[model samples]
Target: MRPFLIALWLLIMPQVVQATTDVYPFESASEQERFRELISELRCPKCQNQNIADSDAPIAKDMRDEVYRMMQDGATDQQVTDALVSRFGEFVLYKPDFNQRTALLWATPLLAVLGGLLVVVGLVIRARQQGGAEPPLSEEERRRAEQLLRDRDGGV
Candidate 1:
């Protein structure tokens, strides 16, 4: 039974491995490199924060095939990117263009840092304006504080 299970596992393992790996026959090493670069630069539409090359989503597979087809047809990198953008929108780009829609996304970090700095400056200014001179305690308050200290120090 153990030997039979091992044989079954061996037969299924090849199919599983083949399913995860994609093979495209590029004309040259440069073409292969370009394909790799494009895939890595493209974000998977269905997988959050994963590049298409590393994604196992069906959309990513389709996108890879489309990229390969376009490259085989002599499409330039820009043309390929534009085509995908037209089909999938700018969200598919790892580095989206700086425009009205994405301006806030690009500026958020700077805005947060500036807001933190403003808060720190405002706190400093308020602290400075308030000054550190505490009012003298009244006679009754002084007697209460002395009692507390004496109790804490065992009447010493």
Candidate 2:
């Protein structure tokens, strides 16, 4: 029983240590608030939809640590964001700067909606035109169609 308890303790020790997080000492409340806001605004690469502050992934933990360290070292919010963006690309930013690369990401939905509206408008116009215009069949064509209809019914 004693040996089993020792083995259990050994097995659990690593997880216990891993689960503990270090608290960063901020110089002021405003600095701490800024740190919190930054983490919430920064996307976690591994978690995809979750911010670094809300994610439990190892990568998020690393990111949170980096943010804390940068803030503690007196780095500005933009500086920290720039550093992470340089390392992880624009995907790590919840609100990426509008640039040529991300222009399509910001504009595609609006463009698609506009395109769909144009298509619907064109379709409505075409439908109205078709509804109003009825081409008259020639007498010979009418006779042929009637004969075909009669033959179809007779055969059935």
* TM-score for each predicted model, relative to the true structure: 0.84, 0.72
How high a TM-score does candidate 2 get? 0.72
Tens digits of per-residue lDDT for model 2, 2-55: 999999999999989987765778889988899889999999999859999888
Error of 1 at 24 (Å): 1.2
Q: Relative to the true structure, how large is the alpha-carbon lDDT of every model?
A: 0.95, 0.91
lDDT digits (tens) for residues 4-75 of candidate 1: 999999999977985768999987999999999999999999998999999988899999999999999999
Off by over 4 Å in 2: 1-22, 132-156
Clashes of each: 0, 0
